[model samples]
Target: MPTYAYRCRECTETFELNRPMSESSAPADCPEGHQDTVKLLTTVALTGSAIGPAASAPSGGCCGGGCCS
Candidate 1:
């Protein structure tokens, strides 16, 4: 299953849904009686060394040894 983000053009509402790949692109109506909803891009969870800025950088000494012992 993948998580999809959706935006309702009629009601200007945003929501998320966990759906199968086959049905992930299906059009969905807003729960608030708005029918002009559109599916946004799907998102994936990142893990391990791909998490943040520090995780992406080398376990370094310093910038030109400025603050390094």
Candidate 2:
């Protein structure tokens, strides 16, 4: 299972959910019962004694997953 973050456009509330990868793109109902919600793009901070080249590299974009100018 993977965790997903969702933000409600109506109430502006944010939340998280644990679901299967196949349902990642599935729509989520906001806790406030708002239907206008979107899955937020999340990021990870890979900081530990054992770091990798990707984590050490400078952030390329907003999410640091590249795909940005």
Candidate 3:
């Protein structure tokens, strides 16, 4: 399940809902029983670096293989 963020225009309350992707566009009510809510655009923060031997491998070419020299 994915979490969707929403904001209620009536109460100006921000809330989150866990729902399916299909229902992400559906209308949501705030915790305070406000129906005037809009889904907020959220962003996922991804932080990581590639690992393993392939990550450290250098680019190979004719010069890298001593063919140009």
TM-score against truth, every candidate: 0.58, 0.64, 0.72
- Model 3 TM-score relative to the real fold: 0.72
Ranking by TM-score: 3, 2, 1
lDDT per residue as tens, model 2, 1-69: 889999999999999999999999999999989899999999976776755654555667777876787
Stretches > 4 Å off in candidate 1: 42-45, 49-69
**Top-down lDDT ranking:** 2, 3, 1
Q: Which structure among the candidates has the greatest TM-score?
A: 3
Model 1: per-residue lDDT, tens digit, 1-49? Answer: 7778889997789988778889976887787878788988655777767
- Cα-based lDDT at residue 21, candidate 2: 97
Q: Name the better of 1 and 3 by lDDT.
A: 3
Pull out the clashing pairs in model 3.
none
* TM-score result, candidate 1: 0.58
Report residue 65 deviation for candidate 1 (angstroms). Answer: 34
